[model samples]
Target chain A: MTEELLRLDGVSMQYGTGETRVTALSGIDLTVSRGELVAVMGASGSGKSTLLTVAGGLTTPTSGEVIVEGNWLSQLSPRQLATLRRRSLGFVFQDFNLIPSLTVLENVTLPLELDGFPGKRAKRPGLDALASVELLDKADRYPVDLSGGQQQRVAIARAVVGGRSLILADEPTGALDSTTGEVVLRMLRSRVDAGAGGILVTHDARHAAWADRIVFIRDGRLVDEAQTPPVTTLFEGADR
Target chain B: MSIRQSFLAILDQGACYGYQLRAEFDRRTGSTWPLNIGQIYSTLDRLERDGLVERTEADDSDHVYYAITPTGHDEVAQWLVSPVVRSTAAPRDELAMKLAIAITLPGVDITALIQAQRQATLRNLQELTRAKRAGGDGGAGDDLSWQLVIDSLIFQAEAEVRWLDHSETRLVRAKASGLAEPMPIDETRARRGRPARGGVPIDGKARA
Candidate 1:
């Protein structure tokens, strides 16, 4: 059996109280195990982003329990929670949020450095992540010097650096062209296949088709879940 | 497309012998639908009989060719401008019929049936994707048509995948909500020489 990296049991998040109150999530139960990528698809204002935020332990849920690697998040002190996030989680965003002044290698190594690993010790993993995305040659180049697609690739490199166990991506391909978007998704898929868990928040079905399973959200509730058929079944009867 | 109309459309470009027309048709469609030389000759013969084409002068190789007449040109223009109308009569779609029957039949695994069809559709989608990727520089002559044909196939396969997803969801919902369980057959009605209500005869004719 694969290791379970993340679990949310009946998680619900609400903002404000009384007339202005908003429920961002309602009784959400989700699990992400090693080597699996689950895609969350929904319309705008449907709580997909909130679900990610709560799962990452960036926001405390109003009710219900969130367990990460068998530890209840509510029991962890703020400092311990911060340490857990730094050591176990990675995030990729739609905007390719790399500091314009930082070189690709510096940006990727920043996470490891922030976690108190020596700069010299962080360099090898940073370089490995960049090479995995075929962007090592651009390691010395600044973010502003790269194309939008290349910048996104660098962001991906930063996410998987240091063997982060859980990846949370929100519209990771939203800013790229169709072909470039496919490249980003392919990279994400490869990483998840290599044993990391992932949750991809996207609205595009074609992109979600690459995930192990797709979860549909509506009105802040999971309305459906579809397991993508095996690749063998999907390509059955194909003329090879 | 009607063979009569296809012949006229091809002849509108220039005069061609039956075999040449057959080859052109195959090339333009990416051989998605191959035409037999015999079928092309028969279609040409009918077009000539209807005065839409006439024999042209034999070339140096002594090969007979036919050119489109004014009527044929007008017909081709009309056909091009007209939108294709879908017939109201149900098409003989094997997949649709199989699913419809499976839902009402006993012990048929509807999920498995739908899954098999979805797999086949996805396979077709992959093949079309490969074809599109291999067809580079679609701006070249003849490449444009092939590209468009592949695009049509891709769109169709994507739609099929979407529909299969929808059908599976609906099926699961129906089962969970107790809406799709087969109703018990009335023995009296079965014993009578009468067809069940809501069930159409295979020939589409009313029973006496």
Candidate 2:
């Protein structure tokens, strides 16, 4: 049986109070199992970013339970939550977010090192992640030396390092050209196929096509969801 | 692509009769655009008139083949090397025309029209995506051409979806900023019971 990597039950988030209250999410129930890639699509201010933040344990939902890797986020202590985030979850952002001072390898290994793993211990996993992105040869190169596409690959490597079970990417391809964006998305898809669960927040339908499923949000609510049929089905009735 | 140039290029390969040329064209293109025999014969007749192709000796079954002339070879080569020119005149786009007129006409629910069109475009996008995925594995020898054709269609459908989304956003912004508003119909004139022009009901029946 596949393992459930993340789950949100009756998730709702609101800011302020009374007339000033703004509900960012309302009754959002979602799940991401191992080897699954879910795409969250919506217009700006539709709570896609908030959903990712809540799912990654960076923000606590007002009155709901967020379970990641079998642990309830609300139940974990602040330190425990931080450790969980450092060890179990990985994030990819639109800006590529690599530390300018660090080399590719160092950027990928930073999370492991912050979780108390020694540099020597983190080296293997860091190298493995870089290799997964086909960038092992660029391990020693700093972010400035690489192209935009290569830098995004490095960011992907950092997100998947240390065998993290969940990957949350917010407009991860927003910075790259269409061709480069596809390459980054392909890498993310392969990583998810290798058993990590992922949620991709994007506005592009073409980008969302890479996901196994697409969830559409509107006005802080789940408006629609679609399961992309396998490519085999897509080819049916096509002249051979 | 010009059918005339395509036929010349194909004839450059070898001499072929009209039916054979049509079949070969269909085979090469994966039948994306099937050609009619009459169209093929007419094009061949025109090519012959232009001194680009000549009737070859008849075969055993009396099949008269057409072979590309030296001039035709040059034309084919030139066509292959030349970039297609895009006309500056507006293309006949039904959706664009509809929306263009709809926005100016009173009592037209522009937002609803945009939403409806968006949904239809999205549906087309989904179908095209499925076809693209099915044709993605261009493993077979003949599959590559078909895959490329499907990819082109997929790209076009995706662009349409993007355009629809952009139009919706622009319309919303325009409405929010009061840059676009439904022109108030002359209700007094309508109440006088005069028939509306161009099907726009000036009668209170028309939506605001």
| Candidate 1 Cα errors over 4 Å, as ranges | A231-240, B1-208
Candidate 2 per-residue lDDT, tens place, B1-208, comes to 5889989999999999988999888777767776678889999999999999999888999999999999999999999999988664556789888887788787888767766665555555556555654444556878777867766776776787688778878998998899877665656634445544545433436534
Candidate maximizing lDDT: 2
Q: Where does candidate 1 clash, by residue pair?
A: none
Q: Each model's fnat?
A: 0.00, 0.09
True lDDT of residue A64, candidate 2: 91
If you assessed candidate 1 against the hidden native complex, which CAPRI class would it receive? incorrect
Cα lDDT of model 1 by residue, B34-144, tens digit: 666777888888899999999887889887899999999999999999988876466787777777767877788887776567556654554555455456536688788
Model 1 TM-score?
A: 0.61
Q: What is the per-residue lDDT of model 2 for residues A23-111, given as tens digits with 9 covering 90 to 100?
A: 99999999999999998988999999999999999999998999999999999999999999998899999999999999989999999
Best model per DockQ: 2
